[model samples]
Target: MTFEWGDLFAGRISGMAASEIRELLKLIDRPEIISFAGGIPDPDLFPSAAMARAYEKIFQSNAGAGGALQYTISEGYTPLREWILGYMEGKGVRLGLDEVLVTSGSQQALDFIGKLLIGPGDLVAVTKPTYLGALQAFSPYEPRYVSIAMDDEGPVLADLEAALAARPKFLYLVPDFQNPNGVTVSADRREAIVALCAAAGVAIVEDAAYAELRYDGEALPSLAAIDAARNGGRPATVIHCGSFSKTVVPALRVGWVSAPRDVVNRLVLMKQAADLHTSTINQMVLHDVVSQIFEPHVKRLRVAYKERRDAMLAALDAHMPKGVTWTRPQGGMFVWIELAPGRCGVALLERAIKEANVAFVPGAAFFADRSGANTLRLSFSATKPDRIREGVRRIAGLLETVEA
Candidate 1:
């Protein structure tokens, strides 16, 4: 049964290292285990009934118009793009509808950007501990990655400048409640980064996938907003990618990138060739859900998730042993934990699963160089408050037992 195949699989896979998140998630599925893996939202938050209604409504209205079951333009449904632009305008990123391009998801937007701009050996700067998915999406392109150092407030300026001095094509950032680290760039840091990137002529790829999940403090302005604030009246150097996966249902896969009109045109062309378009049915359903039901549901998500975030933080504070530190995120799904030095999250994960019956993503998967062995990413988005507390308690007990 052996069939001869070429070395297509021989090439390096972009960011395709063993995914600790998924691996741990498998273990966490056991009835006895508590999972702090996968940055997924709770199913309770999904407006399943409303979504069904929206789906039915779309079919009823458009069945005669081919039921919107047919193929759509690669640029996406015009009304959805217009709605997204309107939503962004409220967030301070003033842009025309033409600048928005929808994709299957925000992940696809990253892949499309990598395909369009990144070639082998092209320099792309990323935060020291960054989004695992970003690394995955961009890795296949084989771009030479430069991991810029970061702090609690966000990317270190000197390091960013040093990386940008080499004239990288773009710098990737998860500005608000960042994926693994759960750190938001301070206002000053945001301003400094924008100013520096502007001077260096380095484009910034801003991933605001968790932007709407803010739980405390005033809403920080997005890097895209900062770009417009600083670089308005010129061709924009910021590529803003975002998704409803966090705010709404991930399965719907509605995400968009707001760039200059020229950039949008190119992405539209690329997208046309990629999948022809995102699903027309999904887009139509989303339009209906978004216009009628999505926003209010998001407000509910905020209230519920904030409580969960608080619970996780409190559990970590009360239960984790000394010398173990974690991020106190105001919003978003993850909390980056730094275990006592020399403790590899990967190595500890086995004990955590088999002994403690708990799981969290090992930090190594998020690093480009596999240097963060002592780090771990715990996602609070999926688990409930009681379970979050229970999970931390169980893991904390394991740490103590392992020590003894």
Candidate 2:
């Protein structure tokens, strides 16, 4: 007498889709494979030693001072929230501590936003090739995704307005060094999108995970900042998510949401239910570390990653086959590429693995309709410069064979 597993599930589970990027990662573990697939930051850049020292400091003096191991407010550690508020102000984003809610990672903010706003069949506006993780995050709620046109500068405002006209529940944007594409929204475009969304009564989920890593050119203002400025004296219609994962350390899982005070209160309530708040012990350690030592760590990352980004760009220019075009990202980890029409990035992966011995994320996974068959994403953050050059050369060789 066997019990059926299908009988125990909700109908929503049937439509739930798996993340292709996560699936692709299974093949990326081999040392022989030069993978440009993951959005992972450099492991070497993590300040493990600094973190250790900070943890010691927290325990020696402050562990029982606030019961670091004991559960605290679901709103997260106040000192950390205060630090983030101060930091945002330093970056020109005006916000109060009450408007920020500490999340487990920026990714969890995505999950929470989806949890709060998305309902069945709701419209969600996204770039044609947006972040796959967002799609995975929101899939369970079963929103109908609408893709807006994107260019080198960012999402086209006309297309975005058209998408908004459909009355989307919200628009999710990576805006700063967008995942997979590695494009940042220009100041003008950012203003246009913000104004359009605000007027149309559409919410904007600004995922600025890679905001701090700009390699060249002036830093662009955050959508949250622009939204705050536009919405009278308070932030409105913008739910901003940021993380230390890309900027500092991923393992510690420190991320945050900055939204209107009321919205943040709701998120905090939801957070209390989710995990009873992100680890307080880790939060205390981070408060100490970021305040005392994070700047130098970020500086080292900038120097090392800039060289790797440049190496990938140089290699692509020298090695990629004709008709294969790629974005030269100013900062952040990825570069988006497009093969000549009629080519399939996933189909080419078999050859890439057996012949070139390199791996890349097929761009189709980044699209809702899975139509960018000719596209691919390369990550320069984790790989060293020499390996980047070698990987690009091998990928080019594979492309030549496929094109031939």
Candidate 3:
């Protein structure tokens, strides 16, 4: 008898689906394809020399004398956690060492959060079109979703209030240049949202992955910072997820979460069961790199990505016909586009790849309710300016062939 491989899997695996972006990335790997499907940073902007020096310095130092090679505390490297606390302070979020836990990446942090907080059938509040990765992270834990309506400013207050009535397990927000939408929550809404959640006894999970990538507009206060101020400098009601993937290096996979002390302890226990700890060598090297060249490296990324964003926007304006619209983000790497009425982004994706040699993520994947069928997300982070322009032109040409 043939073995049935599918029967052995856990029940939770049934809810998991392969990432659409990951699957799409495979097809767009050919040299001729122009892919705007991935929210990847440009390789050119990586601080390779600085990173090399950091690794060299780490291996040459006393910390590397078998110390970094050894297993570390689940809470993370002491000095690195301290450094993260200081970093958060600079962002207006006052966090103590006991309140932070370092994870392999912000993605891991999301999973740990789900493990600690989510219960089967618990309602998880989110924006209508949320980050796909977050949905994936929480799906295994089996949480119901309540997607709040959003406008240009951010989540609408009325919708948020109604969602809060359900007493969700937590509210997940990507307020700074959100992944697929590329829109920032206004300062007023940030504060209001925190206060509203606090009043309803709901936790706020603030994903600040792209908070530091601003190329235009003044920086807005983080939801974590606002929550801290509201609670007299104690961040009790919000958990802030941060990453070096965008600002520093993604391959290092260093990310952190700041929460209340009790929450941190719980998350640390969950993390210990997950991977023992994030790589100690990577943390040490990252700390050294940030100590040496963080500011300059981030500044370099801002300049390069801004150019790419401008190129993509210019192409969209020049090539797109009437009835097509997209967001003009102040910073970050994506431009969310809406096709003419009755056009489906998922349907267009296959034709776009085969005919135009261009690829983008279908916007429906980002929606918790899976409803944005006419929209798509284009990323300008990976491609060069000229290629970005050409890719947009190709996509625009394909749109012309799409019937309304």
Q: Candidates' TM-scores?
A: 0.95, 0.97, 0.98
**Model 2 steric clash total:** 0
Candidate 1 vs 2: which has more TM-score: 2
lDDT of 1 by residue, 194-235 (tens): 889989988899999998898999888888888887765333
Give stretches of model 1 more than 4 Å off: 1-15, 27-29, 61-65, 233-235
Candidate 3: stretches off by over 4 Å:
61-63
Candidate achieving higher TM-score, 2 or 3: 3
lDDT per residue, candidate 2, 14-123, as tens digits? 75787766776777678888988778888888888878887777668664546888888888899999999888776657788889999999889998999899999999
Looking at candidate 1, the ten consecutive residues that score lowest on lDDT are 6-15
Question: Candidate 3: lDDT of 361?
Answer: 97
lDDT of 2 at 95: 82
Alpha carbon lDDT of each predicted model? 0.86, 0.87, 0.91
Q: Which candidate would rank higher by TM-score, 1 or 3? A: 3
Question: Model 3 reaches what TM-score against the true structure?
Answer: 0.98
Residue 83's lDDT within candidate 1 is 89
- Most accurate candidate by lDDT: 3
TM accuracy, model 2: 0.97
